[model samples]
Target: MRFIAAFAVFLFHLTMLSIHTPHGIDVLHQFKDEGVREAYNSVFHIAGFTGVSFFFALSGFVLTWSARSTDTLTGFWRRRFFKIYPLHIVTYAAGLLLLTGSAFRASDDLPGVFLLQSWIPDARVIFAANSPSWSISCEALFYVLFPLLLPLIERIPASRLWWWSAAMVAGIFAVATIGHLYVSMEYQFWFTYTLPPLRLMEFVLGIFAARLVILGRWPDIRLAPATVLLVLAYALALQLPQVYAQTAVTIVPVVLLVGAGATADIEGRSRLLRSRTMVWLGEISFAFYMVHLVVLLSARKWLGAEDSYSTPKALLVIAGCLAVTMVLAWLLHIGVERPAMRHWSVRRQDRDRGRTTASV
Candidate 1:
């Protein structure tokens, strides 16, 4: 599921390489006559936005579901820090090295270095170092709050989980309404889409969904129905105004599909996405998402600013980019992410405390 969402986002960016970069304007020129625009407007655009929302919701779900009663706030935060920051730093540095002078700003990128860019309304700040990283900023905020959020969610009566879910869902819409009515067009997308606090609602929704399943309060929605709902929501997103369509329209379906998928795992039902290959891909999907844009943008720079090619060649470019991105992702996962989690994430006190054998 993570791989699917990351790939959807990758495909969406394939059609949206900025016109500002050298020959970047011509990047999609070959697809001018193709269905790129229609495809984006109808589906890929929604996929790109909702793909990100899916990540936020899934983070909430996974963390809440796996949270241990014995874990302390510092331990939880430490593990999460190890999980994300190493890869983030590697990619953040790589992104800085590749960006053009216009795209890279020393002062503006400071916020992004710490994954705090999402709070700022200015695109220059939010998108400064690595544009896609704006979402990571939101995720970091979610991690910081999750320990606090979990206890609050745990106090809710198990039976009222659905109502809590609805409230979070409503909060998403309220964000859209505020962005639409109050924010200027220049910042509305930033306010509604990139703001960490607003996006946190989806994360909170995920937290609630996990508790629902843990408490056996979840409904009997099959994976098929949940998937169908996702498709229908995507279709509906196409007709809605862009402001409301970003994450607001598809939150429920995305969260439902996530919960349903988890429920399937719990029941050991027919699980097509459970293949070993799929699981490995899901494991590295984070690295893939983090590195793909850097890979694409770097490739474009190397291919020359004025390069143009047939749609076939352009797609071949995408394929090559994917190959390179995946290899880099694999290396990062092996060389950085896993090792950090293994070594640095656990404090000496925790390890010493967990040991079973008595020492002299």
Candidate 2:
């Protein structure tokens, strides 16, 4: 799931690299006579936006999996905050510094450092060297509300909660679809697209899936057959008219993917995500995601390239970015993320021991 989400973001950047921006910053124009534009555009369209959908589904799955085991809201928030905010702040701060000299005034850099730059479009979109950080801002909003919303479903018995969860799913789809149509992306982009509150359904759906699993509702599903069904559903969703509503089309395959993860045995599905390579990628996915853009930006700067808009150049840029991202991610996982997790784990164990001693 993590690899899938990270790959999607990778594809998003790849797609963005192919298009011409208003500022004439397009790299492809440099090589336009090469005749690869059509192919590049087609591939970008297929792979790019789908990354966001994958991230939404994965976020739901991970959050629900954790929620199922959370003993209290405090622990849940503690775990989530420590896990996400540290890396997020690091990435955003890097962007603030990079943008300070050119894109933004030195005075605005301080405010941007704290993520208050989102309200200022000129600061966020134009100034921030890492424009992709916008998604992280939205994700932070999701992280804040998730601890509160997830445990609510667990509070009620399955008999009553199932209906409520289903209704909530329906309500979320309605709002997303209605909002997509009625609200302009210009005004509502942050609210409808980026904000976690509006996007809570994806995570909630995963929670309901976990609830179903706990209640023994999920079939001990076979791997090959389930994978086949998932592929078919994904194809159907893609073939549907774009006018058919975004969330409606997206939620179908996303639901299936989450369902497969919930029901399918990890060992039995050895060929899929459970494989050693995919598992390793998933493990380093967060670091890969946070640092990949940084690598691309740095590489372009180093190579004296402005942007990667041409097909060959974009491919080259992605190849270089992936190599650097993987190496950096592996290093960070070993040095930073792993140690942080271990330290947190040890502290948690000590606290539990202290509480046990007090009770005795």
Candidate 3:
């Protein structure tokens, strides 16, 4: 499931990279003034966003699965923070340094580099970079809030929890839509795009999925055959008029994958997840996501490649970027995440001993 989600995201980015302004933007611009054309772009615009929603649902399920037992919330947060933050901080600082060196001179789309806004062409013409990491910022906020919110959310009766979860999910999207409309009126694109509250539903949907598993309800989860049918159902749902309606389509496949992972024997599934190749790519997904944009930007400028949207060239760039990002992420995972986790473990053990001694 992790592998599939990772690959889906990679494909999302790959598709996005091919959607360059030089080639596709003209097509987009011709339709900009036309309501039908604009609506079509809006539908396509939501594709990558749908991938992110799937990721959120997956994260919620995975994290809740980890904490299903009456576990110490502090320890849970500590492990999660250590596991995710060190890599993020290191990469973020490095990204900032690269942008500093370039002084936003090479790329007109600077807001993305700093993650101040989405890379919607209009939002791109701004005073920073880190476009790719905006989602990271949203993710970071979710991680922080999850630990605090979970206990309360989980305390709701198992039967009633789904209703609560549904409300929370719906509420988030409702507010985000209203917020987006408000921002549009005021031209607050930065606030509109980066607002953490607007994006919280994706993560909360994930939590709801996890809760379903915890209660053994497994709502919407099914076998591959059933999954196929649901996918058709979800695709039909995409024709609905909501922003990010395609999320309806993605949820079923993700649920099937998660269900598969949960039910599979750990010893057997571990082999699949921990295989030399799958583990390698999973380890590097973080770095691959972060660094691929840099590679694309650098290559476009240095190679003077006019065919930025060419599939062949994009595939080649993906291959090269994946190779390098894998090595780098593995190194960071070992040197940074693994070691920090151990250090936290040692500190926890020490604290436990201290409490025991004081009680004596």
Candidate 4:
């Protein structure tokens, strides 16, 4: 799920890089046929918005499902730090070195460096470094609140969990609808999509879902229907005036899909996510997410300087970038991400006592 979500965002960015920058690798525009270009654009355009919603909800669900009573708040925070920050540092430095100065400002540098960029309303800051990492900023805030949030969430009675879940979904919808009706696009995107507090609604929804699954209250929402719901939601979001509705509309189905996947796993019903290939990809997906844009951007600087390459060459460049990104992501996972977690994520004393607990 992580890798799939990350890849969706990747495709979305690969296309957007061209639209967003002058010298970007223009694969989408390279296609001469208007129908083909529009088809490609539509799919990739929504991919990031929906992918990010899936990730935010998945974060809450996974953390809640895997959270441990024995874990201290500091311990949990430490593990999450090592899980993300080292890779972030590497990418941040790379961004500084690789991205054009015009693309980012000194004022925006601190937020990117500290993984706090998503708080500010400015898109440049949020997208400064590894552009995909804005979501990580949200995850950072989510991590801080999780230890505090989980206990309160657990206090909700099992029977009303569904109701609370519905409320959360409704709140998401209300915010998006209101933003669509009243706010400017700038504020609308910030308020409905990028704001840490607003995005927390989705995170909390996933927490509710985790509780339902834990209590054996999760509905038997089959995958097919859940997927269709997601597609319908995305289509509807596109029709709406405020584009930020994309995340809000599809969030329910995303959580449902996550719930179904979790239920299936508990029932020993699905082997695909657990397969070695997917498991390996999932392990490195974070690195892939962190480094993919940097790789694609660099490719643009060095190899894709043309306004738009021929379709064949553009495809070749994309494949090449993917290959390099996979290698770099693998290297990051092994070299920085894994070693940091192994050595620094958990306290040695806790590990020695066999008290290290499962974490997201």
Best by lDDT: 1
Please give, for residues 200-230, the per-residue lDDT of candidate 1 as tens digits.
Answer: 9999999998999999988899899998998
> TM-score rank, highest first?
1, 4, 2, 3
Q: lDDT per residue, candidate 4, 140-213, as tens digits?
A: 99999999999998999999998998899888888887887887866767777778888899899989999999
- How do all models score by TM-score? 0.93, 0.77, 0.69, 0.92
Worst 10 residues of 4 by lDDT: 17-26
Q: After superposition, which runs of candidate 4 have C-alpha atoms over 4 Å from their true positions?
A: 17-27, 30-34, 101-104, 242-244, 352-360
lDDT of 4 at 165: 89
User: CA lDDT of each candidate?
Assistant: 0.83, 0.59, 0.55, 0.81
Q: Model 2 off-target regions past 4 Å?
A: 17-35, 46-48, 67-70, 98-100, 105-129, 155-169, 219-246, 304-314, 344-360
- Clash list (residue pairs), candidate 4: none
The worst-scoring run of ten residues by lDDT in candidate 3 lies at 23-32
lDDT, candidate 3, 172-214, per-residue tens: 5565466446655434434434455655666776777677776
Compose the digit string of candidate 2's lDDT tens values, residues 1-360. Answer: 667767766654544442222112233333343456555544444443445555665676667765545256566656665665566567666654543335554554544355444454342342254555555555666677777776677786777655765676576567766666886655444544445456667667666767667676655655466557655654564665332233445564565566676566444554666778888998888878877666655555556555335556566666877898899888877777776665663457767887899999
Q: Which regions of candidate 1 are displaced past 4 Å?
A: 17-27, 30-41, 101-103, 352-360
lDDT of 4: 0.81
TM-score of 4: 0.92
